[model samples]
Target: MAKEKIVLAYSGGLDTSIILKWLKETYDAEIIAFTADIGQKDELDGLEAKALATGASKVYIDDLRDEFAKDFIYPMFQAGAQYEGQYLLGTSIARPLIAKRMVEIARAEGATAIAHGATGKGNDQVRFELAAAALAPEIAVIAPWRLPEFREEFPGRAEMIAFAEKHGIPVTASAAKPYSTDRNLLHISYESGVLEDPWFDASDAESKGMYLLSVDPEDAPDQAEMIELEFAQGDVVAINGKELSPLEVMEQLNELGGKHGIGRVDMVENRFVGMKSRGVYETPGGAILFAAHRKMESLTLDREVMNLRDSLITRYSTLVYNGFWFAPERLALQALVTESQRNVSGTVRLKLYKGNVIAAGVKSPVSLYNPEIATMEADPTQAYDQGDATGFIRLNALRLKVNSGVEQNQK
Candidate 1:
């Protein structure tokens, strides 16, 4: 029998580094390290050499930042799928894209199985596996964190450190930090460790550093700034009179909005894996884009269509959060959601100031708000009959009136 090749999603972090060493020992498998650079900022330094030196047969570092912004981030912005109405779906959205790329790399490398460092207790495991099943079902999945033998062998951080030392794998082990964080261009999320203590207050600047996306609101510039966004079918096309690529547009927003401290959110949310997790997030660029896109939708989206889509947004958001993104129901709902967003084209102006995104104004050729039909002031030629409302109201009230009358008669 021959050993199978397993390509592990590697991040040069403590967990993935240990997993790389462990896989080589346990499975005797040819381990290929795949690192996707979806806007990790500077955390990607020396990852390729690190993976190879740590016993990987080969290493791949793919630049997926542009694709991440254009495909995953923009479509999510189009749907306005904020998890629990506060989270920008940062970690959630990143999962599918990374997993998709993982499958692509696996096919390229001729690996039979894929592995990731996501814990069974978190939502990420479901996300990684669901995406794998959707894109490449025939490929096997190797989840060390879930395996009884691995969990028993390396029960804690101390044992992992011991394993690394024994294998002569170079690693840095400071006392574990108070919180866990994930970062990308769209947003950064922090939770776990001391954050698990419900009553603990997170410092404005977390222990890792100030939030990746913003400065403190008090430190923002004194002057307000305004920008205009042009939309075509619910996606941002131009910024402040200049057209930009999707990644470029988001990058611009990050600069403009972060300087003003426009996006910070803290909340305790119900995780899909059945636990409540408290997270603090910075989504400066995404927040600005969301506010602008929604303002445009207000102008161009039809009343009934808008209402219907609004009804599904929460459900759609839940599906994404729960890792059901590759399911048939999600596809069906997305089709309907995208169909409604097609007419949502126009321009929106916004003011950024001290963490607030104020909708300055909006305009669209398809606007459904007609002043002539809705104005309270008299228009002599108005075709609307005010008299009809008297009957309409009476009819709506009839059931309540009848029920009360019966009660009074009985009394």
Candidate 2:
């Protein structure tokens, strides 16, 4: 009989590296290591050779930067999904796409089981398993972190290092950096380690090095930089008069935003698993995009429509943060979000200065803003009649007046 096959979400990191070897030894299965190339610059270097040397029977490295931006990142940005009012849902958004691809690879490779290196206690485990269960319910999920035998074998990073050395598995992880990080096209996040302490200041020397996507705000250039973003139905289509692909747009914005230190956030967020976790994130491009997108919508979207959509942002954000990317309610809400962006086509000029994305100007062809009626210069030809306000205010204040009369009578 053929050996059972397992598709492992391989990152060439310490945890996944050890999991790859451990899976091979424990299950005695054919391991196909899969790495999703979601724009983690040098992290993908030599991944194939490393996976092969670490005992993977086959290795698959996929370039998913464009798909990640267009399919996952852009839609979430369009919805203005910001978890806990700060997190751009960077790491949270990437997991579903990665898990979906993992399931696809498993089906294509005829693998009976899929594996991930997400810790048992973290959100990634929930995200990965929930996505897998939604996408491919028949496939078994092999979570090494949840396995007792695996935990016993490698209790800590030191033991994992020793095991890798004994098995000739080359790894680049070290005990020096106490935090764990996840990076993608959208953003870079730093968590765990010293970050577990909610009061730990991230500005200290030890934590400063963890930032890869943006510079320190204090260290940024003295001058502010102005840029224009063009949007088509809510998604950013161009930057500074240049039409670029989704990936290129993200890369360019990230470069510009990073130089100005425009997007750095540290907050203690309520996790989906019912715990409070502190995380530091650098989402330079996403921050720029969100600010620009909102500015454009302000010019084009109607007042009541924008208000209704804004009301749903928190719920939509919660759904995404909770790993409901494939859930029906999320899909339904996304439909409404997509409808809300129908006329959100415009250009927004912004000034980036020392961690602030300031909107300078915004305009749209289908804008509902009327300069004539809005002007305080008192135009005679303006259609908005000053006489209308007397009746409007009296009608609106009738209930208030009636309530006051009732209270006065009682007194």
Candidate 3:
């Protein structure tokens, strides 16, 4: 009988490194290490070699940047999905795409089981497992961190390092940063370690060189930079007069937003697993796109239609944050969101200065804003009748008037 093949979501990091060796030893199976290249930059350096040296029978590093931006990020942005009204859903959005690819790889490689290094206490475990269950129910999920035996064997980071050394797995000093970060084309998230303290001054993260995407707002250039974004059906199509692909849009905007010190968020958010966590995220491109899309919608989307979609932001955001991207509710909600963006095509001019993305102007061919009737000085067309207000106000006040009369009669 052939040995069982287990596909592992390997990051080439300390945790995944140890897990790679442990899985091979514990299961006595052929380990196939897989890494998703979703714009983590140099983190992919020597990953294949590292995984192979760590006792993997085979290694696969796949690039999913364009698919990540177009399929995942753009759709979520169209729904105006912001977890807790602040997070751009950077890390939350990336997980589904990663997990989907992992499941696909598992099927292609004929692996019976898939494993991840996400801790039991974190949201990634839920995301990875849920996505796997939804996409491929037959595949088994092995979460070592959640297993009592695995936890007992390595209770702390020190134990993992010792195990790696004893097993001849390479360990680097830079793997242990003051805080942990998850980077992709959309953003870089900073959490854990010193960031666990909510009172910790995130502004001080600059001095420690903790941020990779943007500079400190105070150190940003003195002059503001003006940029224009073009949207087509709620997705950015052009930046500064250049038509680009979804991947290019993210790459260029990330550069522009980072140059101006935009998109830094620090907050305590409620994790899906019923716990509050402090996270700092740098989402330069995502921030710019979110603001520009809102401005574009203001010009073209109907008032009530926009309101209806706005009411679903919380639900939609929660769905994404809670690892329900493949759920039916999210799919149904996405259909409504896509329909709402039919007329949300426009261009928005913005001023970027010191971490602020200020909207300067917006215009669209399908704009509903009629300035003639809106002008306070005078309405030459007389589209809105001044006399209409009397009946409108009287009808609206009729209930109030009746309630007051009843109170007076009682008195």
Candidate 4:
């Protein structure tokens, strides 16, 4: 009889390596290791060999960079979904895409179950399982971290490391550096280990040369760099007059923003599992794009439309942060956000210097900012009649006068 097959999201890391070997032994099933490349860069090196050597019947490494940027990142950015008014949802935004790909691989391979390396304490576990449940309900999820038996055998990193050593599974984790990180096209996040302490100085991380995507802001070039971004319906279409695809745009901006030392954030955020966690993130490109996009919107979006969309930013950001990417409510919110961007087309000039994305100027053919109507020195156009202020002020003050009169009578 053919053995049941299980699809595992393998990252060639310590936890995943141990999980891969344990799954093969415990389930006695054919393990199909799958790795999704969503702009992890050199982290994909020798991943297939590592997975195969760790006892996998088959290995699939799929590149999902383009789809990740276009379908996932673009839509979220359109809604301006920044968690806690600071986090750009970089790590949060990438989870659903990764899980979606895992489900597809599981379906194509006819695997009855899917597994992930996300810990029970983190948000990724929720994201992976929820996405699987939404996409393919029949497929079973094997989360070793949540299982009592699995936790008993491996209580900490040392246990997992010893298991990997005994099982001939190569791992890079050791006692020296114990922090954890998650990376993608958008950004890289560092947490746990020494970073677990809320008082740890994130600025010191720069001196220690811990950042990967960017240099220290103090080390940035003395002269500011100037660039222009062209947008069409809230999506960046061109950078400095050159049209590029979404993936290319990300790559280019990452390079530029990195050189300028932009987009480093350190904060203590509330986790979905009802705990506070300290995380330090480097999201160079995403910062630049977000600032430019908001500047572009200022020139084109109607005041009311912009305000209505801004009011939902918190809700939209929370949905993504809590791993509800595939939820119906998020989709409905996306539809509304998309409609709000119908005329958000413009070019924004920016100055990049010392970790700052300074908006230099903005212009759009469909701009609502009418200079003729707003000018104080001109009367020839008569676009806005100065005489109208008398009636307008009186009408607006009527409610205030009525309220004051009532209060006075009561007194």
Give the Cα-based TM-score of candidate 2 against the true structure. Answer: 0.96
Off by over 4 Å in 1: 203-208, 380-383, 406-411
Off by over 4 Å in 4: 205-207, 402-411
lDDT of 4 by residue, 1-411 (tens): 889999999989988889989999999999999998998989999999999999999999999999999999999999998998789988899889888988898889989999998999998899888888888999999999999999999998888888987888888976465578889999989889888888878787433566889989988999999999999998998999999898988989999999999999999999999999998999999999999999999889999999999999999999999989999999999999999999999899999999999999999999999887777787677878889999999999999999999999998
lDDT of 3: 0.92
Better of 1 and 3 by lDDT: 3
The residue ranges of model 3 lying beyond 4 angstroms of the native Cα positions read 173-176, 205-208, 403-411
- Candidate topping lDDT: 3
What is the Cα-based lDDT of residue 90 in candidate 2? 91
True-vs-predicted CA distance for residue 309, candidate 1, Å? 0.9
Per-residue lDDT of candidate 2, residues 144-225 (tens digit):
9999988988888899999989999887776688888898998989888888888898977666687888888888899999
Per-candidate clashes come to 0, 0, 0, 0
* Model 3 worst lDDT run, 10 consecutive residues: 171-180
Off by over 4 Å in 2: 380-382, 404-411
- Scored by CA lDDT, what does every candidate get? 0.86, 0.91, 0.92, 0.91
Residues 1-411 of candidate 3 have per-residue lDDT tens digits of 888899999988889999999999999999999988899999999999999999999998999999998999999999998999799999999899988998898899899999999999899999888989999999999999999999999999899989998999997745447888899999999998889989889888443488899989888889999999999999999988999999999999999899989999999999988899999999999999999999899889999999999999999999999899999999999999999999899899999999999989999988999999899877998999889999999999999999999999999
Record all residue pairs in model 4 with backbone atoms less than 3 Å apart, i.e. clashing.
Answer: none
| Candidate 1, 288-371: lDDT as tens digits | 998888888887888888888888889888888887777788889878878988888888999899888998999888887777
